[model samples]
Target: MTRKILLLSVSAGAGHVRAAEAIRASAALSGEALEVRHLDVMDYVPAGFRKLYADTYLKLVAKLPALWGYLYQSSHEAKPDSTTEKIRRSVERLSTRPLRKEIAAFAPDAIVCTHFLPAEMLDRMLRQGDLACPVWVQVTDFDLHRMWVHEHMRGYFAANEEVAFRMRAAGIPATNIHVTGIPIMPVFGEMLERQICAAEYGLDPARTTVLLMGGGAGMGSLDTVAQSLLQIGGDFQLIVLAGRNVAALEALQTLAAQHPGRLVALGFTDKVERLMSCADLVITKPGGLSTSECLAKGLPMILNAPIPGQEERNADYLLEQGVALKACDAVTLEYRVRLLLENPAKLADMRNKARALGRPDAGKQVLKTVLGQ
Candidate 1:
């Protein structure tokens, strides 16, 4: 019998949607009898509410990150009492009407939720006896947030053992959690030679290359980082991936024009893996998907200005792993980059640690665990 797998993801961040897409691709390559489908949870919601859900989140993170951080912590610390349960039920029913309809039509044998919103809704449905399929929640962060927890989930996938330990501490049973590093496209795991990638990308193979990515929305201070890099004296070139942010892209392009051969500014490109292959170091915000891709490539990282809540936690985990440095300001970022350039040994050490921590085959691992194969 062919197994039907529904991957539910939300677009609050690009990571969740990308993780679902990665898992779908992996399932296709697995040679198992499976039918997999990936759905953006927002697609099912009414347009007005959908726009509000996504746009509000982006505005909050971009404009008022501190408030977002405060809400993130407060929600987690709140006790799950009877009133909490009542409020949860009300919110679940209101928000999950579209999802409820989706489940009926899809009739999946197993449901994998890559985002917390769908997981919370699906978990509530299961508890209320509205849905019966086994639920697997993939926590796509290095650190576990309380929002991602649900006692009814059949399994929980975590990025590392430390996160798994935190899951257990959150009152989830040990047997229900699996330490499968966040799923990334298998392309990142490919061992492509840097020289060849540089040649393909028209970069000088002799010069050290730095990649600065601001996630899909281009939400970070890439211009500030670029300015800092220009002040450093080294045999290094800069590549800025200003994803989906035209303003940032234009600003970077203007900067690139000043330093002809030393800088490259890209708008949004599907060639992130190729770019990563050519980069020795990455200066990026601590988003789960981007960091996981960097780790898979064994590239050293300097985390820059992580958002207050989940990103801060992700930055902390990367620091603990010895694979990354946190630089919240342009001055600190410049100093860290220069220090790494002056000391090749430290950069190499970070690369080695990243390789140790990376799970290149995480997609396959997630499939194997969920399917019991």
Candidate 2:
């Protein structure tokens, strides 16, 4: 236990990295005095291998999602097929050469893996007597896929109660699943005083402020939402996060030019927590990280077009649980925003409900489980 905790993640999707960092931050805040390192497992693989990974796997998931879900489901219903499993094992062996070296150098008490690529590889090595470390796989999404569960893994950190149940349904033992929620930014747990936060955002003290993000990639319906909000002609102001979507950012800038004070558009930045504190209602897709942030801060959402697969599932889950409101389409989305913004009573009620679902101590909860505290 004297050695530091090693956190494993990949950069393909920013969620994995964010999840790993959350645990690292949790450990630091818990007074563990632990050194934390977040490493990408794919970095150990060959360049061609990584490219194939991007081309074959990540792209498919992001684009043709239904097929990706089918493949994911196949992993769940896997029969006794050792040929593919052997290939899987062989590729894992190939990657773990660098991973093994790093783990030895770091000498961690436990390995917290946010992505499956490393957990499967590292766990295989440990089980086959090539490595010795307790590997913990943190399922970064709401659903449980087989890649996330390995025989040698010591435990798991899941995002919600439903995921924990799904893990159990998938034959993973109930004891191994820990519902820590999704560890978002370190700023999530920071309790910003609302009035002060509003002042900092230059938001009106009396009128509501809406924060919108389309994930880190910043691809969402912000322009339409902004235009419709103006149509409603409410006294409220808008704060839009166009994360890394430069075109969208530019477009919003042009829109803001027409009514400068009413709209503010920003490129990818790390100030979402401040915006969360300022906003009365937040319009966003149901990305796990964004959703976790909104929940932790007790911000209600006007959930819109969450694609299909994981996002769709997440949106439905939140809406069903009364944590958010789902707008059927763009029309409903704009109307929901105006309706929620105008009625302070309804907005306050929804906000309080969302806050009730917040586990502000999610990081602390996961840290205790990982550190065996």
Candidate 3:
């Protein structure tokens, strides 16, 4: 029988949406008789609410990280039925009526949520008997937060065993939790020739290459990091990806012109896999999707300025696993990069550790488990 699957996510951050897209891509590549739909819950909300919902998070994380971190911790500790929780849930329910209608119309055999927003709503629907299909939640970070948990969820997907262990400690049955790793797009699983990828980007394959990224919104001291890297005396080149930040891109382009072959500045592009293929190391934020992509490519990372909360937790896991080093500032980032550059054995060991942790086929594993095929 053909199966119907609905993958849900919110645009609060790029990881959740990217995780859903990864599963969709995996389904397409599987050549199964399955129907799949990926929905962003934010799309159904009112324009004002949608803007506020997404923008507030970005603003809080960027401008008031300490406050954001405190809120994150407090919310996790708060009881699910606390007055604040109820008020928040009430507001979400009122804004997401259209989403329920859409889900009813689709009538999926299985529902997967990459973000907690829709998962929480659907959990309510399930308890109220409005939704009959099983709803599975995929935690899109190395750490599991309370928001991703629900009493009636059929199962949970985790990025690592530690998250799975946390799920178990949270009273979720071990059988109901699966450590599938965070899903990444199928392209990262493919093998690409480093020389070819380097040539495609007008880079020299023989030179040590470093890639720097600041998530999808370009939210870090990228210019300072790039300049600091340039000051290091080494036979190496740098590639900086300034995603969706025009001002940053312009600044990087200006910097690139000053150094010619030593630097490559790029704006948003879909060819990140190619760049990863050509690089020896990556200096990036520890977003789940980006880190999973780096792991898939066996690219060791110097994790930089991770936003407090989930990202900080992610850096903790990566560092414990020996695949990454955390750099709290530009000076630390430069020092870490220089240390690795001078220590080829350490870089190689990190790369090997990354490869061991990389679950490039996580998307396939997710689909197979969800569909019971």
| Span of ten consecutive residues with least summed lDDT in model 1 | 84-93
**Candidate order by decreasing TM-score:** 3, 1, 2
What do the candidate models score in CA lDDT, each in turn? 0.89, 0.77, 0.93
Best by TM-score: 3
Q: Model 2 scores what on Cα lDDT?
A: 0.77
C-alpha positional error of residue 46 in candidate 1 after TM-score superposition, expressed in Å: 2.2
lDDT string, candidate 2, 1-373, tens digits: 4557788887765788888887777777776667888888777777777777644665765477678767666765675356887786687677558777888888887788888888877776787787676888888666676677777778888888888998887777888888888777667878888788778766775666788776777665677777776777667788888888788898889998998678878888877788788887888878777788888898888787765566777887788877788876778887787677667788888788888877667767877887787
Cα lDDT tens digits for candidate 3, 1-373: 8889999999987899999999999999999999999999999999988988998999999899888899889999999879999999999999999999999999999999999999999999989999999999989899988988898999999898899999999999999998899999999999999999999989999999999997788887677779889999999999999999898898999999999999999988889999999999999999999999999999999999887898899999999999999998778888999999999999999999999999999999999999886
Query: Which candidate order results from sorting by lDDT in descending order?
Result: 3, 1, 2
In order of appearance, the predictions have TM-scores of 0.96, 0.90, 0.99
Instruction: Please count the clashing residue pairs in each candidate, in the order shown.
Output: 0, 0, 0
- Please list the Cα RMSD from the true structure of every candidate, rounded to 1 decimal place: 1.5, 2.5, 0.8
Give the Å shift of residue 223 in candidate 2. Answer: 3.0
Worst 10 residues of 3 by lDDT: 219-228
